[model samples]
Target: MAAAPDSPLYLGLDFSTQQLKAAAIDGNLRVVHQDSVQFDCELPEFRTQGGVHIQEDKLTVTSPVLMWVKALDLLLDKMKRAGFDFSRVRALSGSGQQHGAVFWRRGASQTLNQLHPDQSLHQLLQGSFSVADSPVWMDSSSTQQCHDLQAAVGGALKLAEITGSRAYERFTGNQIAKLCQSRTEVYRDTERISLISSFAASLFLGGYAAIDFSDGSGMNLLDIRTRSWSKVCLEATAPHLDCLLGSPLPSSSVQGPVSSYFVRRHGFSESCAVLSFTGDNPASLAGMRLQQGDIAVSLGTSDTVFLWIQQPRPALEGHIFCNPVDRQAYMALLCFKNGSLTRERIRNECAGGSWETFSAALRDTPLGNNGNVGFYFDTVEITPSAVGVYRFDSEDSEVSSLSPQVEVRALVEGQFLSRRLHAERLGYSIIPGTRVLATGGASSNKEILQVLSDVFNAPVYTIDLSNSTCLGSAYRALHGLAAESGASFFDVVKNAPEPQLVATPHPAAQQVYDHMLERYARLEDSVLRKSCT
Candidate 1:
C-alpha cells in the first residue's frame, strides 16, 4: 500500500544474493510498502543460476556487477509505478550480503558523480567496474591466500584476535590478495574498493560511500576493537591498500543527501538523507530490535544464531562483527548447515510429510527426548564439521534406529541444543531478562518454539515480518537521523510493534537441559574425532 502522502518515510534496501528488495516505513515504524526484483527471474539475460556464476573449478563464485546496478534501476521504476511517494522519504539506509567486494575502475567516481537523470544507472555505468564480476561470500577460491595471511599474522588465533576473524577464504582481504596475485592488472587499475553494502549506498549518494564498520569487520582487515583498518593486515593484502579502501564509517552515519539523479528521475526530495549501509546480518539485528542480552535465531534454509555482545570473544569458529546499532558493542554469529531441509527430511520419513504430525511428535515427547539425541547432517556441516546421521541412547551408545516419535523429537532437541552449546562457546551466556527472538521458515511452528524456549531457558518471541534484513535497514534509516541528536537505537524504535510472545521456558528447562547439554557436547566431540580419523 502507498504510505500516507505527508508521513515522513524511511526507506531501506537489501541487495541480497538472489534479489534486490525494498521496504519503506513511516515515522511510526510501520512498513508501508515493499518490492523486490529477482535477478534470475527478472534479469534472465544474465544467464545466472541462483543469481551467481559458479566457475568451472566450482570453488569460485560471482555475480555480474552490472546485474546489481540494473536491479536498482528496475526496483526504483517498480516503486514509481506503484505510486510510491519518494518525496516523503526523509532518510534511507540499506544492506548487502556480507564479504562481497566491488572494484571501481579508475575515474569511475567521475562517472558516478555526473550521472544524467535521463539515463538508467546500468546504462551510464557500464564500464565503471574494474572487475566485471564481484567475488561473493559463496566463493571459496582464496584458500592459498588464507593460508598466507594466517602465516603472515603469526597464526589463525592471533589473526582472529586482531581482525575479529581468522583468515577466511571468502573474506574480502583474502579475496583482494587473490585478485592482486592472479589479476594484477585489474587490481592495479582499481581506484577504490567498496564492500557490497557501500557500493549500494554509493549508488544513491552519487559518490563513493564509506564502508560501514559493521560490514568492514567481515573483511579480515579491520581491527574490531579499534574500529579502524589494521595497517599490518592491509600491507599483507596489497600495495597502497589504504587509499583504495576509504575510511570506514559508523553504520548509522548520515552519508549525505539523495543524488540529483534520484531527485530528478524518481522524485525523491533532494534533502532526503542517505545513511551508511551495513551487512545483511547486522541489518537484521537492527530490524529485530535486538538489545543487550537478546539472542536472535534465524531458522532459514541454514539456521543462524546471533546476539548482541558487550565483550566479544573472537574465536576460530563463528564470526564477530561491529554492532550496527551500538558502536561500543559487537555481534557474534554461528551458522548451522543442517537446518530446515534436514528437518523436512525427517518429517517426511517419520510423519508422512505432514508438519502437523511432526509438531504433534514434538508436543508429545518429553523434554530432552528421554536421553535420546541425534545428529543429522545430509551434507557436510559447517559447525562441528560432521556428516551422516548418528543417534545415541541414554547410555551414549550409538544406535542405528529410533522410534518415529523419538526420532522427531531428537532432531528438534538436538538442533536447539547445538545452538545453545555453540553460542555459549562464543562467550554468550543466558542472563537475567535474556529473550530469544526467533525468525525464519521453521519458527512458525509453536511446538518447535516451545522446544527452543526450553533449550535456551528464555522466553521466545517471533517477529511480525519475515524479511528482517530489509526491515532493519528501514529502522537504521530512522536511527541515522535520531542518533545525531543522541538517541539510542532502542529509543528510536521503542514505539514500534513488539514481537509476539510465542513461548516461555518450562520451569524445569534449566535442570533438564544442563545435563543433556553436557552429554550432547561430548557426543559432538566424539563424532568430530571419528570424522578426523
Candidate 2:
C-alpha cells in the first residue's frame, strides 16, 4: 500500500551495540511514536594465565541479525498500538555504530525469512566461513594489524593523512587485513563485505549493500574529501577484500523498499522507503543541532568531544578523527575510551560509592590544591595527545606534599584542564565567549558541569533531551526527507524546547584554572616523552 499523500511519515532508527530504537514522525516532524528492543551480541570468553592464553571455545562474538527483525516488528506493533496507520510511513532510515563489517554471499537467492527462519543460515555459512559473530567496533584485538598497516603505509602520520584518522585497532580495514593474514582460507571464501549500517539496510531491503558517507568515513577506507572508497587504501591494506564494500551512497538516497519478509511479518506498507544509514556519533551531532563552531561533548561509557567544521582541517597528530557527516560538513572528533567509566571507578573504589561524597571531599580542598602540586588523571586521554593511555602521578616532588583530599581535588582539576588544552590544540578556542553544549550521562552531574565550565571558562549548557544520539538520528531522518522535498531544516529544529539549565563559569575559579592549565600541559609533555621512548 502507498503512503497517504498528505500525511506521509518518516522513521529513524538508532542501532546501538546492545539494542535497536525506532522513532516515527509525521510530515511536520512531530513524533508519532517510538519503541525499542534489546539484543545481545554473544561475545566469546578467553582466559589468560601468566602470558599464555587459552581459548576455551571458539570465541563467538555474535549479535543475531534476527534481533533487528524483532526490533522492527516490535516497533510496528507499538505504532499500531498508538493508533498509527502503517501506510502513513513513507520514508525509513537509521544510524548505527561505525566500523563493524557484515558479510553475505552474492549467489544466495533465498529471501531473508527462508534463510533466517530455522537458523539454517548460520549452519549454511558456518561450513564456508565464520558466518555469524561479526566483529563489532569494540573488538580491539587488531593492534598488530594496525601496526602492520602503519608500517606498510609508511608511518602513522602518513596513514592519518591518507585515511583521515590514525590507524586504530578497531577500524574495519585493519580487521579485514588481520583476517586475510591469519585466516587465508576464510578470506578466500569471502564474497561481499559491508559495515553494520549498510548491512542492516541491505537486510531490510533484501539486496546488495551500500553505506552512507558518515558510516563509510569511519571504516578508514574512504578518502574524506572525495567521499568515496580509496583504491589506494584498499590495495595498501586488504587487496583481496571484496569491492562489494560498495560505493558510499548519500544519506538522503532511498536504498529500496522493506523486504517482503519484513512487510509480511511486521505489517509495514510495501511503499516504505529505506533511507541510507549513518554513524551514531554524526547522528548525535545532528540531533544536537550542531553547526559550525558549535561543540558537542558526549560523556558516555567513553567521552567523545567533537564539532562540525565547514571545511576539512588538517588531521591533528594526537587522537583527532575527521569524519564526513555529509558532503558539506565534516565532524572533527576526539574519543576518551575510559571517560565516564574512569570517573565511576574513582567514585566506587576511591570515593566509597557516592559521587556526592567524592565531590564534597574534593570541595574541602583549597584552590590550586595548596601550592604547585598537581595530579595527572589518565584513565584514557583522547585528543592530540602524544600518549594514548592514562596514568596519574604528582607533579611536585616536595616532601610536604598535599593531603589525600587535596590530591583528589587536584586530580579532578587536572582532568578538566587537560581537556581544555586538547580543545585548544584542535583549533577550538576555550574562552568565556563561546558556549559549550554538554550531553550524555556526565552532563547530569552538577559538579562535573561546573568543573568543565570553569576549566574552559565557557558557559556549559545541556539540552532538554537526554538521549541526544537517538533524537539526533530521528531529526536527521526528518531533515533529510524535508530537504529532498525543499522544506526548511531550521524550522523543524527551532520549535524544540530550549535547554533546561545553563551553568556559567565562576570568575575566581577561571583564574585558578588558567594557571593550572599551563602546569598540566608541561606535565603532559613530560609523560608523552617518557612513553614514546
Candidate 3:
C-alpha cells in the first residue's frame, strides 16, 4: 500500500454543517466522482436535525465528535462504492465550517496515528476528545464570554483591529473561553485544540494539524495582519491556551502524507500528500475563481458575502481573513445566520413548501417589494446581533403583518439588501462593471438570483456546480500539486470552467434598492437600539 502507479487524481472533502462531502477530479479537472453522507438522513442514529444537537436551548448547537469520525469512515466507504480509486489520488485538501472548535484528549495524536483499520474509527477514537460535544458557529451561547474577551483586550474595536471582527458570540475564542470556564477539568486534560478544518486534516495526517490562516481568522484569535495567533487574545481565552492551539499555517502548506490507516484500509498511496484544510468560504473563493470586481454570495445554511482584497484592513463591521489562495492577500466577509433554513421557513408558510410557488411569489412582486422591507432572523443574526421578525410597510413604518406574497418578497429582498449594504461598506461595489458570483444551495433559484441582481443592481452569475466549497477544496489540492511541480495555481485551475450570467438587474432596480438599503440601515439600527433598551 505504499505507492500505486496511475494517473494522478485530487480529492477534496468538505465537512460542512449538514454532511460530509467529497469530490474527486483528475488533473484535467474532470470530476470522477462526487458524493456525500448526510448526517440527518444517512446517520439517523446521531439524531441531528441540521447536523447538530439542540441541548436544552434552541440556540445551543453542538455536534458529537465521534459522529464526525464515523462520518469519515462512512464517506470513504461511499467513495469505494462509487468506484473511486484512492491510490490514484496524488494530493488531498479539505474545507470545513468555520468558527467551530475541536478539543483533543492528551493522547489523541497517538490515537490518530494508531487507528486500526479492522475496527471502525468511531469505536477506536471514542474518547479522543476532551469534550464530547464541539461548539459550532450556529451556537450563540457565548455572549458573556465575548464581552469578557473584548473587555480584557482594550475594547471591541481594539480586538477587531487586532483580530478580524469584534468578539462575536459564535467566534471560536468565545466558545473556548466558555468551555474552559464551565469545565475546568476537561480543559486541563485537553492537549490540542483545532478549528474544525484542522481537526479533519489531523485525521488524515495522523497528527495534530496546524490551523490554516484563513480558517484561523474566523476564531477571533489570529492577528489578521501577522497571520499568527495573538498572545494577548490567547490570555483572554484560557490558561496555557497557546500550547493547546498549535501554530497556524498557510492554506497551501503540505500537511503530510495521508495516514497509514487510510493507505491500509482504502488503498490510498503512502506517498499521497495532504494540504492544510481551510474554511468553506475561503475555499469557495478558490472554487469560484473570483476576480477583483466579482463578489461571492454563498447561500447555504449560513449566508455570506465576500470579496477578495490585497491588504488586511481589519474592520469592526465585518471580517478580514487571510486569503486562502494568496498568502500575501486578504478577503472581506459578512456572514448572516438566517439563510436557507429561514428562507425555507418562509417558503413553507407562504408558498406551501413549493419552490415553484416560492419563485412565483418572489418574481411577481415588484422590486423593493413596493417599499416593504423586513428583517427575519429565525436565529440570532451575526451583524446586528438581533433576533425576531419585523415588518415595515410602504411608508417605511412598522406593520403588524403583510400578505404571504409580500412577506416572501420582503424576506428575500431584505436578506440580499443587508448583504449589499454591508458589502459596499467593506469596499465592494455592485455596478454595471462588476458581477456577483452566486454559489451554494440557493444559487440555482432564478427568482432568488434575480432578487440578488436587482438588489445589488449588478449581474448575478452562477457556475454549473452549486456546492463550490467542496470543489474549492479539490482545486486547492490541484493547486498544491501544481505548486510542487513548479506550476502556477492559476495555470492549474484556469481552464476548469467559467461562471454563467444568470440574472441582470431591472432598469429601475438601482434606484429602488438605493432607497431600500438606506431605509434598512436606519430600521436595523432602531431595532438593535430598541432591543437593547
Highest lDDT scorer: 1
- Residue range with the least summed lDDT across 10 consecutive positions in model 1: 1-10
Per-residue lDDT of 423-524 in model 3, one digit per residue for the tens? 766656554468888888999899999999998888999865466888889999989867867776678898887888999999999889898888899998
Q: Candidate 1, after superposition: displacement of residue 280 in Å? A: 1.0
Tell me the whole-model lDDT of each prediction, alpha carbons only.
0.93, 0.64, 0.87
Query: How do these models rank on lDDT, best leading?
Result: 1, 3, 2
Better of 1 and 2 by lDDT: 1
Candidate 2 lDDT (Cα, whole model)?
0.64
Off by over 4 Å in 1: 1-4
| Clash count of each predicted structure | 0, 4, 0
* lDDT for 522 (candidate 2): 76
Q: What would the per-residue lDDT of candidate 1 be over residues 18-38, giving only the tens digit for each residue? A: 999999999888888999999
For model 2, name the residue pairs that clash.
287-472, 318-384, 319-383, 378-390
Where does the lowest 10-residue lDDT sum fall in candidate 3? 1-10
TM-score of 3: 0.83
lDDT of 2 by residue, 1-533 (tens): 33344587777787777667777766555666777655532212212121112234433133444444455555556667877666666677777777777655445424443444333323333332244446666567778888887777777777676666778877888888877788776666666787778766766676655778777777767777777777767876776653657677776566778766556655567977777777777677767776566666777887777766555444544333343234566676776665777677667755778888778866676656654444333443455344433434444443433444655565566666766676666556543346778888878887777777777777788864445556666666666666677655566677754665567777787688778777777767766776568
Which numbered prediction scores highest in TM-score against the true structure?
1
| Predicted structure 1, TM vs. truth | 0.96
Better of 1 and 3 by TM-score: 1
